[model samples]
Target: MSPEAIRKFWSLIEETQTNILLTLDNDALVIWLSRQLRREEFLKRVDTRDLNAYISERLPLIRDLAQERLAYQSHSSG
Candidate 1:
């Protein structure tokens, strides 16, 4: 994904206030993004415990919003 898209994804995560991530399926895409966002470099920049909790709590919601955004972009550009 583009940097702007990635930024927006994280922004969505930050905006959400639910635990959708923990309830979602543990598929490749979810796992990959979770691992990427949880890297040592990124974790070091924030409160590790809080960040993990926030991401786990919001990932699914963030994914849903990201997909919606992508679909909108695709349709608009076509």
Candidate 2:
């Protein structure tokens, strides 16, 4: 992807993360942060060969979803 496309992709990810956070309470955030802390350690101790395969599969689904969303927006606007 070009730099602009990569930046846009990350912007989308950040937007989704922000929306998710808007729905979460502070207590829930603390709990989620605790889990994430554990996951950092867990990752260092585990094998991750399946991670790449899973991402390869999910990436196409994400791409198709974005395409469908764009099409819907275009159709609605027109």
Candidate 3:
């Protein structure tokens, strides 16, 4: 993937709602991310056709990010 594509992908991940990221199971999360990345606006901003492969490869990291975010939220709120 191009550096720009990688940056955009992470940007999309960061922009995604925490609930969606945290609540969805792996399959559902992949579906959700696929749909999101396939949207016209996303496509217009970045070429994501090649990103499908990256998504599966990075899913574990994505889930880890969600867990970290949840922990941070809990810690901050407590």
Candidate 4:
């Protein structure tokens, strides 16, 4: 897709994520998980935590979003 379209897609997701974060009362588990993702210090805070598993669980939405964006671009480009 064109650069503008790509930017717009990112913008939409950023806006969506932002709105979701703002409107929903994120539970404690989600907050902790998000912190685990964001904080380097927290990575070591808890022993016996499987960070990879956490990463794996969180990766699909990112992959799906990218795949969906690519498919949409392909359809529009053809």
lDDT of 2 at 31: 43
- TM-scores, in order shown? 0.44, 0.35, 0.76, 0.31
Pitting candidate 1 against candidate 3, the one with the higher lDDT is 3
In the range 1-78, model 4's lDDT, one tens digit per residue, is: 334433543454443433343343335334534454434443444332454344335444544664566677679999
In model 2, how large is the Cα lDDT of residue 57? Answer: 44
lDDT of 3 by residue, 1-78 (tens): 667656767888988988898788887887788777666354545444456667878898998897888899899999
Task: Please identify which of the two predictions, 3 or 4, would achieve the higher lDDT against the true structure.
Answer: 3
lDDT of each: 0.54, 0.44, 0.77, 0.45
Candidate 1: 10-residue stretch with minimal lDDT: 14-23
lDDT of candidate 2 over 1-78, digit per residue (tens): 334433443454334444343344544543443344334443333334343333344454544555666677679999
Q: Which candidate has the top score in TM-score?
A: 3
TM-score of 1: 0.44
**What TM-score would candidate 4 get against the native?**
0.31
What are the clashing pairs of model 2? none
Model 3 — TM-score against the truth? 0.76
Model 2's TM-score against the true structure: 0.35
Q: What is the C-alpha RMSD of each candidate to the true structure, in Å?
A: 8.5, 12.6, 2.6, 13.7
Judged by TM-score relative to the true structure, which candidate is superior, 1 or 4? 1
